[model samples]
Target: MSFALSTTVDLDFDRTVAALREALSTQGFGILTEVDLSGTLKTKLDVDVPRQLLLGACNPAYAYRALQAEERVGLLLPCSLTVRAGADGRTLVDAMDPALMVELTGTSALTEVAAEVRSALRAALDALETR
Candidate 1:
């Protein structure tokens, strides 16, 4: 199974990131953390890129349920959404497939939560694609 779903968007990188954030929220997800890979790389390694953003998204209810099912699930707490610029000047938005992580963890309790997260992420990805 694919670990992530991705699509190249015609929008600019920054707009893509913003649209993804809005979509995720509309699907009941919140951005718990955001990392600017471009900025971090520039600062840490003096490397520069056009744009690269990482968003850690989470639905609180699902998170709570997952935690109840597996205490170590925190290792994969928030699903990640990435926005990066392509060589063609378009932006790409990618989201981690919760089902993949759930399978990796090997927990039956996470089955429902994984389904919900996958659906929510799919909705968010669809919205991003439209924008």
Candidate 2:
């Protein structure tokens, strides 16, 4: 089974990023970190590249519950939301399917949390589409 879902949209990179942040907010997820790979690579290694952004997203409640189940679960605390520009000049939004993600760990406590996360993520994706 796929752990993530992705969709390509016609918006430019910057707009897409904004839409993603909005979508995340609507789903009760806060973006804990944002990484601009293109800029980082260029500034750190002098390698110019296309647009690529990584967002570390988390729902604090779910994270805390998951951690209570397993402290080491922090390894996967924040889910990744990646946005990238294709060569065709289209933007793509990708996020993990928390249902599938939790399954990988085989933790019973994560099942209920995964359902909540899946709902939030689905809302996020719908929000992106409407934007």
Candidate 3:
């Protein structure tokens, strides 16, 4: 199974990142954290790589539901998505598949919550494509 739902945007890295943030917000996901992956690597290791950013997106309603179902699930509370400049001259956006939570936790209680989060993520991706 694909671990992520991804798309290639015709826009440049900066534009794609902005568009993705707006799309995610439209789907009720607030970015809780932002990590400059490539910048960090370059600063620490002196390695050059494609521009990349990691966003920790979260929908409070789904997060609350998931936690109610399983306390330990907090470890995976925020959904992670990556935006990067692809070698092909376009920007790539990849979002984690929420269904994995159900499979990993082995908790039937999280099934509905996972599906809901997955749907929102799908909507965000769909919006990016159709926009």
Candidate 4:
């Protein structure tokens, strides 16, 4: 199974990133953290790489539901969304599939929450495609 849901955008990297954030917000997700992979690689290993960012996204209600279902689920809280420049010059956005939570936790209770999160993530990707 695909671990992520992804889409490619023809917009410039920065603009694509901004649009993704806005799209996620429209689906009730907030970016809790951002990691610049290029900067980190350059600083830590002196390696050059394409522009890449990892966004930690969270929907508060869904997070709370997951937490109540499994206390340790916080370890997987904040679904990961990545924005990176493709070799073809387009930007690629990838969101972690929330279904992984169900696979990892083996909790039937988390199924509904994961489905809701997946729907929101898929909507964000769908919006990006139309734009």
Give per-residue CA lDDT, model 2, range 1-131, as digits (tens): 88787878888888988888888887788999999998999999999888899999998988898887767778776988889998898888888877764676777778888788878877787777766
Residue 27 deviation, candidate 3, in Å?
Answer: 0.8
On a 0 to 1 TM-score scale, where does candidate 2 land against the true structure?
0.88
Residue 102, model 2, lDDT: 63
Measured by lDDT, the strongest candidate is: 4
- Give the per-residue lDDT digits (tens) of candidate 3, residues 38-69: 99999999999999999999999999999999
TM-score of model 3 (CA atoms): 0.96
The candidate scoring highest on TM-score is: 4
Worst 10 residues of 2 by lDDT: 97-106
Residue 6 error for model 2, in Å?
A: 1.3
Q: With candidate 3 superimposed using the best TM-score fit, by how many Å does residue 126's alpha carbon deviate from the native?
A: 1.4
Question: Candidate 1 — which residues are off by over 4 angstroms?
Answer: none
| Candidate 3 vs candidate 4, TM-score winner | 4
Model 3 segments more than 4 A misplaced: none
Say what the RMSD of model 4 is.
Answer: 0.7
The clash numbers for all candidates, in the given order, read 0, 0, 0, 0
Q: Residue by residue across 1-131, what tens digits does model 4's lDDT show?
A: 78899999888789899899999999999999999999999999999999999999999999999999988899888999999999998999999999999898898889999999999999998898887
